[model samples]
Target: MRTVPKSYYKHFSNSEQIDFQKQSSLITLPQPRAHPFVPKDHPFFVRTDLTAHEMGPPKTVRTISQEAFDEVVKENMEDLGMEPTEALQDAIQTLSLQGVDLSGIVKCVPGESSLKDNPLIQSLERLKQLDLNSKDKFSDEDLNEMMGLFDKLIELCGGNEGSVNAAVATKNGGVELVCSICYKMRCGSKRVLDSCLKTMALLVHDVQSTETFRTGGGPKLLVNILIDGNEDPEILNSGFAVVAASATGNEVVKESYMELKIDELILEILSRQRNDSIQSLYDAIRVLLTPDDDQVVASQVYGYARRFAKIGIARALVHSLHAGLSSPSLISASIALKAVAVNDEICKSVAENGGIDALLRCIDDSGLQGNKTVARICCSLLSKLAGSDSNKSAIIENGGMDKLIVVSARFSDDASVLQEVMSIITVLSLRSPENAARAMEAGSGDLAIQAMLKFPNAQQLQRSSCFMIRNLVARNPENSFCSVMVSRNLSDRQRRTTKSARMQPLMH
Candidate 1:
C-alpha cells in the first residue's frame, strides 16, 4: 500500500489493518477495533457523546424497557416470597420517591388489614399514643400533620364499613382512637377540629364502633366540641354526623343522650336556624327519641320524647315534614315524632305546631305510600294524635279520614300499614260521633271493612277492622257498614277474631 503511514497504522491492530485496506477505496486508516465479545452497534456505548451544556450533569442509571422492569420486579418479588400486591406497593412507593413515571403500573387497592398498616395510619397511631402530658413537646406543625394524616387515612378508607372497623380495631377498644381524636378536636383550632371531626364521623360508621364510641365517652367529647365549635358549620355538621352515626342503631348509645346533654346541643344547632343544620338536628333528635327494641331504652326515649317537643324539635320536625314531605329524613322524623307523640302533652304540641296538617299531608302523599316505613310511622303518629278530640277533629277537618282510607287501599297488601291505618280510623271512630260521621262520609268504614276482608289472616288488621266497623255501626246504627259486616258474615266471632293470645289486646 505504498507503505501506509504509521499514523494510520497507529490506530489499527494488525488484524484490522489487512481488512481495512481490502475494504477501502483509497489508502484509509483502519477502523478502531471493537471487542468481538461485545456487539459493535450496542446503544449502551453508541449514544455516549454529551453536549457542552450537559457536561456537568451526573450520569443517569440505565433505563430498562418496561417489560424488563416488570420481569425484574416479579422475579425479585418471587425471590422474596412476597405477594404481587405487596411488590406493586413497594414499586409504587419506590418509584414515587424517585419521581418516576408511573403511567403503566397498576395501582394498589388496599384491603382492611393493609389499610390499617399504611404508613399514614401508622403515624396517626403513634400520634394518638403521644403523651398529651408533654404539652409543648410536640410542635403545632407536628400536631397538624398528625391530624392531617388521619384525615388522609379516612379519605383513603372511603367510609368502607370493613375498613372503618379495621381502623377501630387497630386502636384498642372500639373507639379509643376516635375518643382520642375527639378529645383533640375539642381543643384544636377551628380548622383542625373541623378536620378531626370529619375523621370521627367516618370512623363511627357501624353499630359496634358506634357503641364503643358511646361507651368510650365519645358522645361527651363530641358534645363539648359542638358546644364550643357551634360557630363553625363544618365542625357542627361533622360532630352531628358522628353523634347521629353513633346513636343510629344502638339503643344504649341513644340512652347516653340525656347524660351527655345532647338534646340541648341539638337545640343549639336548631336555634341557629340555619337550613343546613335542620337535617342534622332532625337526625340527632330522631336517634335520641326513636324507640328501639330494648324496653329500657324505649322507656327512656319515651320519657325524653316530650323534652324534644318542649324544645321545639317537634315543631321543627313538623315544619320539615311540610317542607320535604317526600324526604327520607322526614320519614325518619315522622317516626321520631311518633315517639314524641307518645307523650300526650307532646301530641298536643304537634297539633299546635301545625303538625296535624303536616302529618295528614304525609299520609296523603301519593309517593309516600310506597314506603311502608313512612306509611306505618305516619299512621302510628296519627293514631296517637287522634286520641285527643281536638286532634281527631283536626285530622277529620284536614281530610285525614280520606287520607287514611286512600293509604289503606293503596298499601292494602302491607299488613303493618293496613293495621296502623285501621287502628287510627278505629281511634277516630271510638266514642266520637262526629269522627264516626266523617269516617262514614269519607268511606273509611268501607275501607276498614275491605281491609278486614283482604287481610283476614292478619290478626291485628282483622281485629282493628272489626273494632272500627263495630264503632262505625255503634255511632250510626243505620249506616251500611253494619249491613256489609252482616252481609259478609264478618260479624261472626269465629271469623272476625284470632285465637292467638297476642291478639287479646286488640280484642279488648
Candidate 2:
C-alpha cells in the first residue's frame, strides 16, 4: 500500500504479463480415430497427413469377438431381402473369419437332429441350397459354417439312424461325401460324440434285433452305407468307435453282437491288424462281453474265440497278451481273454489250440509293465479249467503256482492288481487245498503278505489275502516267514526320489 514498492510492482507486472499471454493463446490437438488400431477416423486415419511421405499402406487384422460375429450373422440374414441363401452363407463365412466357437452342434441326442427347430438353424436352412457334387456341393466354406450349426443338435441321435440325412443334404453326392467325412472327424469330438455314439449303438442293435437284418437283408442296407463294404475305413472305423464306446458299458448295444454277421464284421475288421483294426477288434470284443438282450450271444462269443483260437485270430490274441505285458489293452484284452475263459466251448478251443502255453509264455516274459494283470487272468482261466484233478495237476506241472508267486512280487504295490491276483489264488485254494499248499511252497504267502501290507486298505484284496494267509499257515507253520514279509510291506510307502535332469522319474 504505501504505493507498493517499485521493485514489488515490477515482479507483479511480470506475473500478470505471463497470465495475459496464456489467456490469449488458442490450443489445437489431433482428433481421435474410430478404429482402435488406426489413429484417426479418415480412410487413411493412421497417417497424420494424407500427403506426407508415405510408407507402406495401412494394415488391419482385427479378430472380432463371438458376440460381434453372431450379431453380424443375424444382421446379414435380416438384410437378405432377395437372396437369403447367399446372404446367410456370406454371414457364415464372415462369422467364421471372426472365430465363433462351435463345439456342440452335431445332434440333440445320438441319432437325432435339432437343426430343423433351432432359430439360428432355421435361419441357416432358409439359406440351404442342396446341390451335391456341384461347385456348391458342401464347399469347405459351407462345411465349416454348417459344422458349427451342429453344436445346437446333440440330443436326437442315438448315433446311427434318424436325421443324419438332414445334417448334410446333397444332390450332387459331394455333400454326402463331405457329410460322412464330417461325421468321421466328429466321432473324435468330445462335445457331440456322446450323441454320435448313442446313435451307433442303436444301429448295431437295430441290425441284430431285426430278423430282417440278421436273417433277411438288413445288414446289406446298413453295411453298404455304414460299414463301407470294405471301402473307406474312416467310415467303418468311425462306426466301430461309436460301437466301442457305446457297447462298452451300455447293454442295449452289446446284444447286437449276437448276430453271426457281427462276427464276420469283427473278423473282417481284425484281418487288417493295424492300429485301427486293433481298435476295432477291441470294440468288437467289448460288444461281445457286455451283450444286453440276447442270451444266445454267449454262443457267438464262444464261436468267435474258437475261430480265432484256431487261426490267425488266436495268435493275435496271444500277441495282444504279450503286448499287454508292456501296456496291455486292459479292457479290450480282458474281454478277449474273458471270451476264451468264460465259455466252455472257448476254453476247449483255447486248450486245444495251446493257449495255456501261450499264457505261460506271457508269464515268463521279464520286465513287463502290466504282466501282473495278464497273470491274474491266466490264473483265473486255470482255476476255471481245473474243474477236475487232471486240470489242477496240469497247472502245477506247468509251474503255474511258482510263476504266479514270482509275478505277484512285481505288482505287490499296485493294490488293484494285487487284489486281482490274490482273488485268483483264493479260488485255487478253495478248489484244491493241495494246490494251495504247492502255491505256499512256491512262496505265495511271501507275495500275498507283501501285497497285504502295501495295500491294507483294499478290503476285497485284504479279505482274500487273509484267507490266503490262513491257507499258507495251514500248509506249514514254517511259513510264518510269509506273515513277517507281509508285515514288512505294510509300513513302506514308495518314496519319490530326487529327480535329476538325466533320470526318468517314476510317477504314481
Judging by TM-score against the true structure, name the best candidate: 1
**Clash count per candidate:** 0, 39
Q: How far is candidate 2 from the true structure (C-alpha RMSD, Å)?
A: 21.6
lDDT of residue 340 for candidate 1: 65
Show model 1 residue runs off by greater than 4 Å.
1-174, 187-195, 198-216, 247-256, 276-278, 290-299, 324-329, 365-377, 407-417, 449-467, 470-476, 479-508
lDDT of each: 0.61, 0.45
The alpha-carbon lDDT assigned to residue 182 of candidate 1 equals 54
lDDT of 2 by residue, 1-508 (tens): 0111122122124554344233212212234335433224221112233221221232222333334434444443453331344344544443232222222222231113233544434523533442232342344564454445443332333334333432322111222232343344332333233333333333332322233223333233334444543444555655555445434433433444434355556556566545534455565664555444443433344454555545455445545554435443533554565554544554555555555565656655631545555556665545555443444565567777776666666665667656655655655555455776777777776666566556656777766666666554544545556555554554443111101111321110
Reference-based TM-score, model 1: 0.61
Misplaced by over 4 Å in model 2 are: 1-222, 225-235, 248-253, 271-277, 291-316, 319-331, 364-394, 469-508
